[model samples]
Target: MRPTRRRATVQHTPAQQMLGAAEAMLRHALASGIVVPEAVVETVELACTHRRAGGEGELEPPTPALLRRLARAHAELVRLVAPATPRTILLLSHGRRSRLAMLGPVRLVRQMLVAVLVLLAAFVALSTTDYVNGTGGDILNSTGLSLLVNELFFLAAGGLGAAFSALFTAYRYIAEGTYDPKFESSYWLRFILGLMAGLLLPALVPLGADAEAEGISRPLLALLGGFSASVLYRILERLVGAVESLVRADSRELRAARRAADLAQASDRARLERLELVGHLRRLEQQARAGGTPDQLAEDLGRMVGTLLPVAPQDADDASDEHPQPLISPPAR
Candidate 1:
C-alpha cells in the first residue's frame, strides 16, 4: 500500500513572504562566514506595509539606501560560499597531485642538474680503482686478470658512490632541523635521473685527470664529485619548493575564479528579486491609492507575491499554499 503524506501550510502576506526570502538568504550568508551590513537586515525587518504595525515604526518605501545595502549583502553572500583554499603544507609535499601531474621550468632545470650529479657520482665510483692502481697502489698488478678484477672494483665503487650520494643528501636534509616532511619536495625521479647521468662519469674522469686539471688529485676529484652532488641536491630542493609555490598560486587563482563567478551570479539573482519586489510594492501602492480594502489589497498582493519572491527551499516541507506556486508552475502563459 502507498501512503500519501499531507503537507502543512502557514499563512503569510506578500510582503512577509518576500521578507522571509531575504532573511533566509541572509542566514545562508551568515552560515557561510559572510558579514553583511545591519542596515540591510533592518530594512527587511522594519518594512511593515504588509504587517499590522500596531505600534511598530512605519517602514518607508524602498529608498536608494535600502537597495544599496541589499545589493552589497547579496554580493558578499555568494563570494563567501566558494570552496576552501589549499594550505602551504599541502603544496610542498613531493606527493602533491599537482607536482606529480606535470613539471615546470624550475622543476625541469632542477631535474637536469640532478641527472648530472648522479652521473658524476657513478663516474667517481667506477674510476676509483684505476686511480689507486695508477698511483703506485699497483693493486691490479698481481691479479693477472687485471681488467676483470678492476671491473668488479669499478662496479663496487659505482654502487657505493650512488648509495652514499643519496644517503648524504638525506642526512643533510635531516640535519637542517626541519622535522616536517610535509614541506619536503624530493622525489624518486631525481634519483633515477641521477642514475641516468652516471653514464657520463667515465668521460668526465679524463677531464679531471687532464693537464688542465693539474692540481686536481684523486681525493680532490672525489671531493668535487661528492660536493657537486650535494650542491645539486640543494638546488633541486629549492627548485621544487618554487614549484610548490607555483602550484599554490595556481590553486589560489582557481578558488578566486570560482568565487568571482558565484559573486556575479548571486548579485544578479538578488538584483532580479529586488526588481520584482519593487514592482509588487508599486502595484500595492496603486491599489491603496485607489481606496482598495485591506482584504482586497492582500488578495491582489498574494496572487503576485508567489511570482515576485518564492519561498526558500528549506521552507518547503513546513508550508504549502492553495494558490499555484509561481516558480514551480510551467510558463505556459
Candidate 2:
C-alpha cells in the first residue's frame, strides 16, 4: 500500500474570522479614499496569512508587532470615522445660551428712541408760541420782532426735528447690530442738516400778523427747541427695553441648537473607537495560531498595543542566498 499524504486542515476561531472580515472591508474602503489606520491593515494581513497556512486549531496570541499595528490602526479608524451623538448635541447647545442672550439688548434700544423723539417734537412746537421782544413789544403782536422771533422758533424747531430723526435712526441702526465706527462721520452731517432745518422752518411757516406784533424773542424759542430734543431722546431710551428682551430669548434658542450639533459629532467618534479596538483584538488571536510561539505572540501583541506601531516597508530588501564554496578547490581544478 502507498503511504497517504496528510492534508492539514485549518479552522479559524469566530473572533479571528470576524477580525479578518473587518480588516478586509477597512482596506477596501481606504483604497477608495476612505482613511483607515495602518495598524488595522497590518493585523488583517497577518490574520489572512495565518489562515492560509493551515494552523487554525489553537487560538494563537498575536505577536508584539501585530498587536501594536492593530492598536494604531484602530485608533486611526476611530478618529477618521466616528461622529458625535444626540445627547452630546444637547449639552453643547446649552453651553452657548449666552450668545442668544445678547438679542435682548439690541431690541430694547430701538423702542425707546421712537417714544422720546415724538414727545420732544411736541414740546418744542408748543414752546415756539411763548416769546417776547426786548423792546417791550409783544412779538406775537404783529411787530417785526415778533415775526422774526416766530420764524427763529420755527427754524429751531425744524433743526430739533432733524436732530431727533438722525439720532433715532442712528440708535435703531445700532440696535440692529449695524453700529460701526465709520458711521460716526454721519453724526456731524446730521447735526449740520438739523441746524439748517432749524433755520429754514421759520422761513417756511408764516407767523400770524398778530403774533409778529406780540414781539416773540429768538432766545426763548431756541431754549424751548433744545428742551424738546432732550425729552425726545430720553423717551426713546425707555421704549426699547421690551424689544431687547425678545431678542435675548431668540438668541438663547440659536445657541442651544449649535451646541447640540457639536456634541453629536463627538459621541460618534467615541463609538467608532470602541468598535475598532474589538476588531484589532480578534486579529491578534488569529496571527498567533499561524506559526508564532507564545512568547513571540505575546511580544507581537504587546507591540501592537503599544503607542508606536511600525509600518511594513513597501520596498524592503530581499535576503540573498549564499552557497558555501567547496572546502577543497582540487575537485574544480
Candidate 3:
C-alpha cells in the first residue's frame, strides 16, 4: 500500500478565528428567522478568506481591510439583534373557572405547530386530485367510475373547511386576547359574518363557464379549495404573529401594535442623508464636466463634508454569493 500522507493542518489567525465564530453566530440568528442580511455573512466570510490568503502562521494583527469588514458586520449585528424590552402576549384560555392566562414560550410553540399543519393541509389540497386524472380520463378508469371519486373530493374539501373552522374558533380566544364572555359572543357574531364572506368570495370568482370539465366542473372544485384556504388564512394571521414573536423572543408587534418610531425616523434620516449625498455627487460631476480646476473642486467638496458622508451605505447588507468589498473610505482621487 502507498504511504498515506497526512495533510498539513492550516492554523487560522486571530482574525480568521474571530470571523469563524461570528459567522457561526450569524448563522444561528438566520436559522431562527432573525433576518441577518447577506452582507453581514459576506463580511464575515471575506474577513476569514482574505486573511487566510496571507498564508499559514502569519500572526499579524487584523489588517485595516479586516477591521473595516468587522466594523460592517458589527453594525449589521447591532441593527438586527439589539436588545429591546420583551413584549408579553395575553393568552386567555378556558377551564371550569375562567381567568386570565399568559402566552409563555411553550404555548407559542403549539401555535406555530398548528400553523405548520395548516400549511401542510393547504399544500395537499393544492397538489392532490381526486376528480380528474391526466388526459381527461376517469380517476377509476378500470371500472369506468368517477362519480364516487368526485364525491370523495367534495367530502375532502368539506373536511378541510370544517377542520379550519374548528381551529379558527379555538384560536379566536387567543386572537381576541381576552376571555370576556360578552366580548366573545360579540366577536363570534362578527366572525360568522366574515366566514360567510370567505365562503361566498370563492363562488364569486369568474371561472369562465365553457372551460370547466363536464363532471362537477374544475371551477366549482377550485372554489371549494379557495374557501378552505381563506378560512385557514383567517386563523393564520394570529398564528404567524405568534410564531414571529416566538422566533424573535419579542412581541413588539403584539404589545405596541406599531413599531418604534425611532426605527422609522432612522429610516427617514437615512433616506434624506442618501438624497443629499447623491446631490453632492451630481454637483461634483457637473464641476468635473465643466473642466473646473482641482483647487475649486476640492474647495466645493470641503464645504460639504457632513453632506457627502457615504453612498450605497448598506452595500454589505446582503452579503451573498457576490462578495461586495466593504467601503473603507471615499473614492480615490
Candidate 4:
C-alpha cells in the first residue's frame, strides 16, 4: 500500500489573510493592466464584509468614504507596482477601436453623398437633352401621364429620396458615435430647404419658346427639379461629414487632455504617498532611538531606511530629497 501523504497547511492571521488577498487581487489587476482599481476595491469591500460577519451574512456594507479610499489606494498601488507604458495606454484608448467608432459614420456619409451626386448628374444630363419639338411630346407625354400626376410624382420621389437619404446618413453618424445635436439640427434644416428649392425649380424656370422647343415636358422639369434637390442634399451631407470630422477631432483631443490630467493627478498622489512613507520612516527611526535591543534597532532601522531609499539609481535620482532614502536597492533577489 502507498504511504499516506499529508498536505501541508500554512496558517495566516486574520489581518494577514485579508491583506494578502487584497494585495494578490491588486497585483493581478495591475499586471493585466485591464481591470480598473475601482473593481478591486469593490471586491475587497465585499470580502471584508463577508469576513467580518463570520460567514453569518450579518456584515455591514462599507461606507462610501472607505470604499473611495480603498479604490484610491488600490490605484496608487498599481501605479507604484506596475506602471503602464504611455504607448500602451494610448493604443488602448485611441487605437483601432476608437478610430473606427469615430470615423465609420463619416465614411458612410461620404459614400451616400457620392451616390446622390452621381444620380443627380445623370438626371441633369438627361434633362438637358432636347427630345421634344414645339408641338409638345416629352418623356411624361410619352408615358401618357397628366401634368399634375407627373409633377406630383417627381415632387414626391424627390422629397422622399432626399428625406430618406438624410435620415440614413444621420442614423449612421449617430450609430458611429458622431452625433452632434447642433449638427443634426443644421443638417435637417439644410435638407428641408434643399427639398423646398427642388420643388421650386420647376416654377422658377421661365416658360419660354426655348423651354417648349427643347421638348422639356412638365414631368421632365419636375424630375430636373428633384435632381437639383438631390444635388443640394449631397452637398449638405458632405458638409456634415466635414463638420463631424472636426467635432470628432476635438473630442479626441479633449479625451487625451483628460487622460493627461488623470496621469498628472496620479503622479501627485504618488508624490504624497512618498511623503507619507518618509514621515512613517522618521517615526520608526525615532522609536528605535528611544529604546530597543541592538538587533531590533538594526532591523527596524533597516526597514525604515529601506522604505525611504530608492531601489535603483534612477529611482533615487527621481525621488524627492524631502523623502527618506529607500530601503536596500530593491532587493535583486
Give RMSD (Å) of candidate 2 vs. truth: 47.7
| Clash count per candidate | 2, 66, 6, 8
Residue-level lDDT tens digits of model 4 in 44-139: 666566457665433344556655655555455446434432222322233335445443234334444664666566545544545422333333
Clash pairs detected, candidate 3: 38-318, 38-319, 39-316, 39-317, 39-318, 39-319
lDDT of 1 at 180: 38
- Please, what is the whole-model Cα lDDT of each candidate in the order they appear? 0.49, 0.52, 0.52, 0.54
Residue 173 accuracy (lDDT) in model 3: 45
Q: Could you tell me how far off, in angstroms, the CA of residue 236 lies in candidate 2 after the best superposition?
A: 32
Writing each residue's lDDT as its tens digit, candidate 1 over 67-162 gives: 555455444433443332112112223223454334311233245345546656655664555433534212333345554444344333333344
lDDT of 3 by residue, 51-98 (tens): 567676664567787677787786566455434101112122122123
Evaluate model 1: give its lDDT.
0.49
Best by TM-score: 4
Worst 10 residues of 3 by lDDT: 84-93
Pick out the ten consecutive residues of candidate 2 with the lowest summed lDDT.
84-93
* Tens digits of lDDT, candidate 2, 1-333: 999999978676545645553554454356548766565676767766755565646666566665566555544554443342222222223323645434223322233345346546754664545553332222334466566555555454555555566666756654333444355556546555555545433333345557546764443334333334444344445657667766666767788988998899889987887787777777777876676688877886786677345565545433222444566777655
Least accurate stretch of 10 residues (summed lDDT) in model 4? 85-94
lDDT of 3 at 144: 41
- Number of clashes found in candidate 2: 66
- Candidate 1 stretches with Cα past 4 Å from truth are 1-132, 135-145, 148-165, 176-199, 205-223, 226-333
RMSD to the native, candidate 4?
A: 39.1
